[model samples]
Target: MYSFLENSTDIHIHCCPHINKRSTDIFEVIKFAEKNKMYAIGLMDNFSNTSGYASLVKKNFPNLNLKIFGGLIMEPPAGGVSYENAKISLEYSYFENDGAKFISFPTHHTRYIAIQEKRKLDYIQACFYVPDSGPTNETTKILELIANKNVVLNTGHLSPKETLTLVKAAKSLGVKKILVPSNNFNKTTIEKLKIHNVYFEFSYFFVSKATEVPLTHIDDESHKIKGLTLKTLKDLIEAADPKNVILSSDCGVSILPKPHLGFYQFIKQVHELGFTIEEIDYMIKTNSKRLFRI
Candidate 1:
């Protein structure tokens, strides 16, 4: 057992398994969480409402000792990036236990796909567009819904410029919590996110060789940290500074180690790289709870 995580209120996991062809299912993830005594675990299924599954697990497995939350990924499968679809997903699980607490921008259908596929400057799906100028009437509708619902919004795979625009719009809409899934931003962008009071997530799985995650280059050396080396990620984290930074295991793929194990390894590696346990705890534990309010 990883004693460090036992009943640890400082460790929160963002992408726990059993969804999207992952190695483990909701039930298995719950067992893992219970065994490890995690603080909280987030369930995110691309284009589907998996919070109900998390709700069911919590209902049936009353003895499981961990907090499990769920969210919706706004993609084609979940009816694209439309306000109506986003509302439906929000209402679908909003009444269950803690409700669906998260709503992500397009993930698989963002500019990340264009970069990953080496395609022209186009999104994976043209349903929604977050222009460099800012949110449009259609985009504002979704942002307003997110603000009204008080759900955490993730900047899913959008380019830095687009993400900054979206963040500004979200801030204008009075969004409580805004999370960026990557650390790939320039110092200016990082400062901007901080100014907007957004949470910047640094995922260990992205840089893990076992996961083979794809990365896009940015102007800063820190933005190029993804998929480079763990030390580079460590450097990026240090450079990012603390405050709203968060540490999460975007681990679910079969090729990588299990989420809990991989996260433990990440913490250990970072500690060895010079970060103190208190600093790591703040990212995994404090910032997570603060973001999700769990």
Candidate 2:
């Protein structure tokens, strides 16, 4: 287990057999988490309904040795979330839904550069429903459902302007939690999301490229510790209380390094970039405890 992660427990990661991943089993993930000294791990996978062998591991392995939780990758917005739509979201098992929508929260300056420079419009569309849900009755119904439970309202793919509007609406409705994961990252989006006091998810994907890596740059050095790196992450911390930031591995891809190294390497690099250990700990631990309600 990585000693670095022991200090900053991680609560978000994708570990599923349904997908062709290098680290495709619970044993591997758990061992890595422990070996790396990562405090914990949370499971989430796109189009999956269970952690496959995770339950078996949990049943056989649940203990103080390490911590593990389940999560899901939700549908992209195709239309505004109505009550019916929100109900659908709630129906997903933690393995595939977690009531967290995979989308961008804003549309202005934040992600425009990434979109224009890297986002594949056609590929992204095929993967998710864009302009999926507009603000309408569907939106109200969805918000109301989330407001009633410990659901997480994530502005996954929306842009800056869209993020502001969507986050404000979700907050007003009293959704239990709000998240702006990787897809919602950008200067303007982070700036706007910080205003709502929502939790922001950070991952090692930004540090190293991997399959389906949504975070890529013009070159290797650009995504390095400096430059446009985790600007959104830093901004989120500066904008909100440190306890509002959360951490994730976003690992399990075939080409990326094992999650253990990914988690530690992320810290090593970010620290080299000037983030303090306490700040990092909050992003990986305290912040997620409140956001995921674990």
Candidate 3:
């Protein structure tokens, strides 16, 4: 209630340089992030397919002086949300069969796949199969890529098998920083993922307001809210190593009065539920930097 969201550092945010969502200008978003004491912001655009926006931030607000890490949300032949689609997007290098199986990320009608936690793999596979057959040896692709430390093989859309297999592949490959940043509803298997270097990313608004966002819905037919709930957050923190966990606002839906406000509330609630300050610090400061190589 007293704003535990203070001194927040958002590891992920898609802003003006990347997406012209127009909900708030990049300048204004930066101002808000600074006012909120957000230490680092990852500037990603689902389009443009490059980190070019990072340079724009440096050009405009050199004075603000934030780290401003840049990345793109890659899509496979299956889909593209933020221009993260590239043949090499999943592959680190052509020398080995390395890369990620982005699968079904951006939805058919909307932008990303919506799956019940139990059915995420089915949903993702359906997407990966879209416009073409899925990869033959996706596991090898994940392993070879993350093993080298040059790429972060995120589990975009796929089943639990994808998440688990990717983690194992990443581990076998030498990936120390794996991120399971699927839609919040994806039931992140903490133990299975923890065997490999990975952290589960829970979104802010999706958990708080289940019905509004496509990925966060809990309807039994299409998507089940599943892991996108308060108890899931608590359980993950309790069951897993805090250092291997991360939090994100998502802040995608247009209903927000202010961006990151709902995320602010989500993190605050997590803290109030007895998650250690040290753990929060690890997720907010250390983990993301280590994973993204920022």
Candidate 4:
């Protein structure tokens, strides 16, 4: 029988100095995972490629028994969804092993963030621009590239309409895995995502009342917005199949619970709300392992 900690693999962890002022560094994150006996952690550095760094760190710390994965967020910092950039990142691995396990679309620099925060239109740079017909030609090309690479695609802060279009196109192009950030998902699109086998992720960072990552570090105005309620999460879980659901700590802010504790609490709360252990395991562990291909 696997221990409780053995099952939880955190797919979202914001480390330091990547747009968001994260409390933990790559090394600290690994230490925490080792101490808690976690299987893996995905270093979600905003607008940066942390995959190579994470692989190097793991090599340096040969004694630690944790898998660290990293990827590029197709935001401005990552050269904004260019095919060449994506190819370089996707090919980056330890020797022949694929270290770049996940690839997310724009996060802070999305049109959705601009509208939500009332930022200037020029402030946000999107991975793909959509017109009345559908995603632009460039967007389609990028989707094809992503599909061929077969990396996990995270819908980072894209509006519901954009997410729907992107998911539909990505699936048709052969992108096997998709992940939608927690609050970004709504009832209208749940069933559609299920049809495509896209995974909807739930995180504790936004919901935790206690601010951990210090408001000073979070430059994005959306972080100031209130997080979704546990009830909302429950509804989302019930609405989707257990296999297509993923639970993670989008945790790393100094003000919130550490990754392990936040993840544990997320499970505890959902369980208290009547989510079965099997269901929780599938979301928190099984789905993430499959997504990260660990």
Q: Write the per-residue lDDT of candidate 1 for residues 256-289, one digit (tens) a residue.
A: 6777777777677767778777787777788888
Give the per-residue Cα lDDT of candidate 3 at 62: 68
Q: Each prediction's Cα lDDT score?
A: 0.68, 0.55, 0.52, 0.74
lDDT string for model 4 (107-162, tens) is 76676766666666566443244544666766777778778777788877777777
> What lDDT is obtained when candidate 1 is compared to the true structure?
0.68
Off by over 4 Å in 4: 1-3, 19-21, 124-128, 210-223
Model 1: clashing residue pairs? 10-285, 18-24, 18-25
Residue 162 C-alpha lDDT in model 1: 84
- TM-scores of all candidate predictions against the true structure: 0.85, 0.71, 0.70, 0.90
Q: Which candidate model has the greater TM-score, 3 or 4? A: 4
- TM-score computed on alpha carbons, candidate 4: 0.90
Minimal lDDT window, size 10, model 1 = 216-225
Residues 1-294 of candidate 2: C-alpha lDDT, one tens digit per residue? 434677456655655663243555667788877776665677664444233334445567657467665533333322222355345545443344343322222222124343544445664343322232545555556666667765666665455565567777777787658877643355556666776777776677654565234432212312222223455556645655456666666666666666776776777765665678777677777867666565
Model 3 bad stretches (over 4 Å): 1-7, 16-22, 76-126, 129-149, 182-188, 213-227
TM-score winner:
4
Decreasing TM-score order of the candidates: 4, 1, 2, 3
Error of 2 at 279 (Å): 1.5
